[model samples]
Target: MLIYLSIISIASILCLWSEKSYKKGELFLSGFSTFLSVMVLSVFSGLRNLSVGIDITTYGKNIFETVSTFGPSVAIDYYSRWADTGYVLFNYIVSFFTGNIHIFLGVSTFVVELSFLLFFKRYRAVLDPTLSFFIFNVVTLAYSFSILRQILSMAIIIWVYYLLTKGKYLSAILLAVGSVLIHKSAVFIILIIFTCYIITKFKEKINQRYLLLLMILFTLLSTIILTRYPETIDNLIDDLNISSIQLNNFGSPMRFILFLFPVLLIKILIKEKFIQNNEEYFLYLISLITMSFGWLGGINYSLTRLTYFIIPIYILFISKKLKIINKKSINLIIIFWFFFIFWWLIGRGSEGGVIPYIPFWKEYIVF
Candidate 1:
């Protein structure tokens, strides 16, 4: 835990320095700092032990060993029986090079972090990119150590959204399909993008408040319906061929509170006219809608993973809003929120099986 905190602190400092460089138009320094920070995180995550993540020791390791032993073709065919094509192909490619699972972990971490950094670069104009990077480190980066494949899918989704915003429709469509291949939960990205597009087109006809209210109502209705008709939900889950275990796992109150915080913050920002740009407003609204859906689907763990793809947008929107507030107020709010998220991860995030940190080198030491 101390090592994790140290890495985050160093990364945050570098990000702040990067911001200073950006302000001075020192492009090289700014880019270097950002790159160095990303490398710090990626290296730390990639070098961790196979036993570090709960899933890594069990499911992740098994997949790696299976692919390494059976050869890519057989492994791909076997995994295709259940897993998505992109993930299966990813495993095949990684395993083809070596039988060591650690190598795959390292490669995956590097790819995901690099992709995320690229996405951040593209959207730096929309927010205080440094602060956004810090927020991601504190809130989402550590969690990625546990859900590697999902995080990779999330990176692809971010790129897809960026492409859509730039009016690169064909590229966005291709990327969105790729994201779905990486993780089926990424299908929610399509819904989010489509909804945001509709909202943008009909901004004058629609009320943001009404849309939020509708989301809240939908959340309540879905929760009540699922709770009352478990059999129906089970049938739906079966038909979708999703994991049955997800039906038994519900989100905690803390998770709901974290999701709600952004909704409330966005509302306050909008009311104060802090968010005036249509595209920015649409992104925040989509974030809220996705989070609401996540909360509504809290009964199913797999469904909740859908929200992860949009969390970077939420973080960026909040970071943007904070920039317009009084410095002291922003400082206090950010400090409080950062610590709260840190506490949650150290405590409740044990479900990811990332607690009691252990380094990969430790396993090879004779001592």
Candidate 2:
């Protein structure tokens, strides 16, 4: 774990320094540095033990083996018994090349990270790429070590969101549909995009305070509904065709804080006139809505997974907002943020099966 932190910290520094070169039009230097950072992350994550993510041994490996041995039609039919179409198809394509699970994992890691880096380069104007990348590594990247398909869906949704922001509505919608095929959770992305569109169209008539209050009310209502009618939630999950294997009865209070703090911070920044962007505001609202739903339906693990869809947008908003603050204040903020991330990585992160890091090579040797 220490090694992971050390490497990520170094990468963050290099990325921060390279931002200067990016501003000076030194495209090759900036691109090379970003590529190196992403490569380190991809290689490390791809090569980790199947045990590292709890699901890899129980679910991922089995799925890959099924695909390799049975071929796409059989594999897809088997997985479609429980999982979504996109994930099963993904496995089928990868499995065609190699029966080795490690190769599948390696390919997945490279594809996901490369897609993210390409998107980041195109949309870095929305946020400081360095800070956005750093926050992603610390707060959300490890979670991908567990839920690979969902993370891939998230990457696709992010790209779709970028397209929507650029007025490429047709492309965004098409891509969003493709994302939903990957993971049912991505349906929330489509829902939220339409929600944001309506809100923006009525920005003049709508009261922000009323909107916040409505969100709180909606959250409470959803909680009541979830508690009193769990079957309804179950039916909804079934309707979406999502896996219901990992349902939990308790909410993650600590994770709730982790998701909520940046949200409130962004609100504060907006109120102080330090930041003003409709797209950021839209993302903030979506994060609040989804996270509130997660808290409300805390017993339903799939609802929490929905929160991952919008987290990238929140990271971008926070990163951009941080750039507008005074350097001294930003420094203090960075200190606190780093401490929180480090503490999470050492504590809860490990508890969640993301630590005691073992590379694929090491695990292979031990076996």
The best candidate in terms of lDDT: 1
**Candidate 2: stretches off by over 4 Å:** 81-83, 234-253, 274-277, 326-328, 331-335, 338-346, 349-352, 363-367
Candidate with maximal TM-score? 2
- lDDT (tens digit, per residue) of candidate 2 on 92-172: 888778878877777787677667666655656646676666666666666677777778888788888778777888898
Shift in Å, residue 177, candidate 2: 1.0
lDDT of 1 at 115: 76
Candidate 1's displacement at residue 109, Å, is 1.9
Q: Score every model by TM-score.
A: 0.83, 0.84
Residue pairs clashing in model 1 are none
Q: For candidate 1, give the lDDT of residue 281.
A: 64
Instruction: Report the Cα lDDT for residue 317, model 1.
Output: 66
Q: 43 in model 2: Cα distance from truth in Å?
A: 0.9
Collision count for each candidate, in order:
0, 0
Shift of residue 22 alpha carbon in model 2, Å: 2.4
| All candidates: CA RMSD (Å) | 4.1, 4.1
